[model samples]
Target: MPQPSSARLHEFRIVSNDKIAQDIFSLVIEAPQLAKTIKPGQFMNFEVPGNAMSLLRIPLSFARADADAGTVEIWYAVVGDGTERLSRMKPGDTSTVLGPGGKGWGVPAECSRALLVGGGIGVPPLVPLAAELARAGIPFDVCLGAKTASELVGESELDALGAQTLSVATDDGTEGHCGFVTDLAAELLQQGGYDYVATCGPGVMMQKVAEAALAAGAYCEASLERMMSCGFGACSTCNVETTEGMKGACMCGPVFDASKVVVW
Candidate 1:
C-alpha cells in the first residue's frame, strides 16, 4: 500500500551550494523543522515554478540532513526542466519541499557488514545512509560507478565516514577499477563477508547488483527512479510490480528490497 505526502510544502532557504560534476549540484536547504524528523531512505518532493518545458513536482531523495545545522543536502543531476530549475536555484532562493517520503535505506545495527552501491544521479540518497552507518560505527564499504572517474561523487565524504570506497568506470583505464559498479560489487562479494547490499542507480545497474547480492545470499535493498506526479500515493505513475504485487514508489517506496522488484 502507498501513502500520501504529509506536507504540501516546506519552506526552506538555500544556505550554501556547489557543483560536484557537469550536471550535478549539491545544495544545503535550511529547513530546521523537517530535518529533525527526516530519516534515512526518505525523500522530499519539490515544487519548481512552472516553466514552459514541464510542470510537475520533482521528488528527490533526501541526501543528508544536518539536523543540528537546520539544513538538508540533496544532490541532483540536471536532466530536464524540474532538475534544471533546481540546479539554477542559487543561495537564498526559497524552495518548497515535501516529504521525508518512502521507506529509505535499511541499516540494521547488528548486521555483519554493509555494502553501499550508487551510480550516476542515483548516488545522492545513499550518501547520508553511508554517513549514518559510519556514525553507528558500522564497518561498511561503498562501490560507486560512473562513466568517468571525474563523474564519481561523494568518495571523500564517504571515506571520511570510514567506508572503503571503490570507484569504478566503464573505460577501465580510469581510477580504482574499470567496469560496472556491479563488477566492483562482484569483486567485493568475492571476499565473502558482506551481510547486506543497498543500492540506487540506473534500474539496469541495480538489477545487476541485486542479482549479484542474490547469488551471494546477502540481503539487498534499492531506491527506484520513475516519472512522478502528485508527489504522493494519489498518482499511480511510479508503481512497480513486485512478487507480492504492485507498489508505488511515491508512497510505499522509492526504496525496496531487491527481492521484491519485478524487473522487465
Candidate 2:
C-alpha cells in the first residue's frame, strides 16, 4: 500500500487571498511546519470555514510552497458553497488542514527533457512540480490549456521558470492554439525528444495525453481529480480502476502511471 499523509493536523492562518481570474482564486497560508514537508502532487484538505451544511473538507493541491517563509499556497475555483465561504474569509482567519496527502510525481533523473501539461484548474499543482524540476536541473517545458483565456492561470509563472518550451491552447481559439490541449500534445510528441510527460486536467484531456505519450515511447504519469470526501483512503470515493485493480487515489495516488490506469 502507498503511504498516507502525516497524521498531524495543521492550523494555518490565511496570509493572502486574491481572485486571479474569473472565479479562480489563489491562497497563501502560513503553516511553517507543513510547508517544510509538503511535496509536489500532494494535496491539502482544508476545513472550510462556516460550512455547516457540508461536513466534508475541501481538497486542494499545493500550488506553491515557501519553506523559508513558512507558507503554502493553493489555487481554487469557486464552484460551491464551501469555496464561496472560503473566498469571503479575511487574512487573519484560521483553518485546519491535513496534508501533503497522497503519492506525488517522481522527478525523472535520467531524462533530459520532460513535458508538464495542465488544463484549467489543474494548472496549479504543475507549478510546484516545475519548480522542483528546475531545482533538480531537469530541463522541461510546459503546456497549459483552458476552455477560454479568462479561465487560464499561471502561464507567466511557468514562463518565468525558464522552461525549455511553453505551449498554450484554448477551446475558444482566443489564445496560442485552437482546439484541445491533447492536440498540442500530439504535435509535440510527433516532434520527439521529450522522454517524460506529466499531466493533470479533465479526464478526456488526460486520456489523450496518455495515448500520445505512449505512442511517442515516453513515460507518462497523471494526477486524478476525483470526488474525494476524505483526503484519506477511508471514504473509498477516490478509488481508481487500475491494472492492479481498484486503488485509493488519496492513498496510492492522485498521481499514477498513465498507462496503468483505465482511462476509458
Candidate 3:
C-alpha cells in the first residue's frame, strides 16, 4: 500500500469544465501544491459552497495531473444534484479543494509490465496510473468498458498516451469487444507476460476481475469506490470488509490487494 495523503485545504479556481462523454464532464482545478503531490488512484474532496443540498464535500479522483501547469483534472458523470451543480460553475469560479487524500495504487519495482482495467465512471482514475506506467518505462495495456461507444470518453486520452496496447469492450457491439473489460483483461492475463493487474470500476466487475487474476496466479490490486461523508477517515461510512477485518476506504484505501478484499 502507498502512504496516506498529506491532506490540506486550498481554494482552487476552476480552470476548465468541459463535457468529455455522454454525461461525464471534466473539471480542471488550479492547485499547484496539491497537484505536485497527487498520484494515480488518489482523490480530492471538494467543498462546493453555493448549494444548500451539498452539505458535504464531494470526492473525485484525479483524471489527469499536470504538476508543471499546477492543475489536476477530475472526470465526473452528472449522476446527482451535487455533480449537476458542479457542472454549472464557470471557469473562474472557486471551490474549497481538500486533498491528496486516500491511499493510491502502486506498481512494485520488480514489475515491468501491468494491465489496467476500468469500467464506466471508474475509468478516470486509470488515466493517471497508465501515464505513470508509461513514464516509468513500464509497459502497460488498458482495457476499458462502457455500456456503449459514446461512454468511452477516456479512449482517446489513453490512445494519445501511447500505451503498449489499448482495448475496449462495450455492452453493445458498438466498440471493440462486446463483453466486459474483465473478460478482455482475463484473456490478456492468460497470455502470461503481465506482472500485475490493477482495476477500478463497479464492485461486481472488480470482483470478477480479481477472481480471474487470482486464478491466473497473477498479482492484482483494486481501487474501490464507496460513499464518503468526510474525505478523511473520521467518518466510518466508507468502511470495507477485508481479510484483516474492516478497513476504511477514505484512509486505508480506495485501493487494496485483490486477494484481501472480501467481495460479495
Among the numbered candidates, top lDDT falls to: 2
TM-score of each: 0.93, 0.97, 0.96
Better model by TM-score: candidate 2 vs candidate 3: 2
> Candidate 2, which ten residues in sequence have the lowest lDDT sum?
1-10
Please report, as a residue range, the 10-residue window in candidate 1 with the lowest summed lDDT: 165-174
The total of clashing pairs for model 1 equals 3
Model 3 C-alpha lDDT per residue in residues 1-264, reported as the tens digit of each score: 425557899889999999988999999999999889988988899887677765898899988988999998999999887888899988999878889898888788888788889999998888998888888888888899999998887888888877789999999979999988888988998888877889989999999888888887778989999899997878889998899888888888898888999853
- The positional error of residue 145 in candidate 2, measured at the CA in angstroms, is 0.3
In model 1, which regions exceed 4 Å deviation? 3-8, 50-54, 170-172
Tens-digit lDDT track of model 2 for 1-264: 778456368999999889999899999999998899998998888898795668898889988899999999889999999889999988999989988789889766788789999999999989998998898888898889999999999899998887888999999998989988888889998899989999999998998899999999999999999888988889899989999899988989999999999943
Per-residue lDDT tens digits for candidate 1, residues 226-263, read: 77787677778888889988888877778888888996
In candidate 3, stretches whose alpha carbon ends up further than 4 angstroms from where it belongs are: 1-5
Tell me the deviation in Å of residue 195 in model 3.
1.4
lDDT of 1 at 77: 81
Instruction: Sort the candidates on TM-score, descending order.
Output: 2, 3, 1
State the displacement of the C-alpha of residue 241, model 1, in Å, after optimal TM-score superposition: 1.1
